[model samples]
Target: MRTLVFLGLLAGFGFGQGPQATLPNLVPQVVSPPDFPPELAELEGLHDAGRYREVYEKALARKDAWGYVLASYAATNYARYQASDKERQDWFRRAADAAREAVKLAPGQKGTPSLNASVEAKAYFALGQALGRYVQYAGLFTQALLVNQIRSAFSKAIELAPDFPDPKIGMALWHAEGVARNICLIFGCRRDQVQVFLNAAEAQRSNSKRVILGYVDGGYANLLINDLKEAERGLTTALSLTPKTAEDYYEQERAKGLMEELKRRKGGSR
Candidate 1:
């Protein structure tokens, strides 16, 4: 299957597309988002050479309008480095903000409503993902807070463009937002607070590739909640739906790890 063209669709998701874009033959000049000023090929070379940290740093420098694209690239690597919450959150927040800026700047003189709408969807979704990552590591309360942000991103992502793969949406709302809020309620999240983001993520089940990534993330969230059965199911499904593109290798490694863990648990039980 042709891997979906995922990057530029959102931020903080690590759908890196360095040279893939066809700079228009006719379009207004706009500076690329602020971020690490590395060419994609150089970054790719770094990644290929196993210099992941360098690649991440390179991406982190891109903090302009299309910053999310680079930030997402950075965060994807940061997650692997066992970064501290403060460290990673700072990066994620920066990336999300940059992505949002890209959306605002995306509307050039020639931009149609359709294009603007798509840009908004990507920006919001990227912000939500970045915030969600921060919330997850902060604590139960943080998780609860992040749920609302996640839903908000997905909600906007859907409202602007509601025609993504079904599983993508499912992960965002049904799994990421829904399960987190409900679980957080047991901790301290307010009822109304939970409803806002939960409803939004739930309302759309076809937001984007996020639905699938959400499921994968949802499984990890389940682990955070200590729901082994659910974690098993979620991770299993996540592995199944996970894409195999070079961009998806990080997730693929994670899914494989989850499978191994689940199997270990099952074997232990037996």
Candidate 2:
């Protein structure tokens, strides 16, 4: 599948390029916006209750940008957590397709203020996230195209809303994964920028589970670089957060798993 080439494309296209900043050692205190759409909030509640299939069905019924975006999140979570191996690929494809539709329906960011243009940012982020999950099982012939699409989606998301942290986190993960796979040897993956992106994201605190994921991804990036101290710090911060959604719970569990791995590595270094 020429994964090295794919990483090269991701770097050349400026996937992880963003503002540089230092992430504070503590999780930022933030609150969810009170003006959040009630209907979407209800779906998020259902998703938090772990009723992913229900949320997916209900969100899909709305047949709009917001609906499709939520549906994509639910679908991806269900596929990752509940779907059988045989079903995972199809579910991921469905998730990606739903997110793509959301992107199409979302208003363009041309004249819209970044904060007011969240729909397009969310839609593009979901599209990138879903395509990333799908690529794991996609055929080699399609994987290249999917990789490029994922990069484009996330890049557009960050461009549409520079303050949005999820896309920034996604970009950090892209660089971390490239470094983990030694793709930096091929394309100058710029592993240092991994922290740069994460730092920029952390500075924009939010109540969304995406912020928690930023920590998880940061821990993962540090883990990839064998920076155990920072890795443990990041994972610990992720674990300290209250899970506000099913995805948060899922990722915290992942954090725990990573912590165990970190411990093992630490012991091995003795």
The top-ranked prediction according to TM-score is 2
* Model 2 per-residue lDDT at 19: 16
Model 2 CA RMSD to the hidden true structure, in angstroms = 7.6
TM-score of 1: 0.51
| Backbone clashes in model 2, listed as residue pairs | none
Q: Residue-wise lDDT of candidate 2 within 85-158, one digit each (tens)? A: 78877888889999989889888422232245477888998999888778767665466566667778888999
- Runs of candidate 2 with Cα error greater than 4 angstroms are 1-36, 108-117, 185-188
Residue 225 error, candidate 1, Å:
8.0
- Sum up the clashes in candidate 1: 14
Q: lDDT for each of the candidates? A: 0.45, 0.71
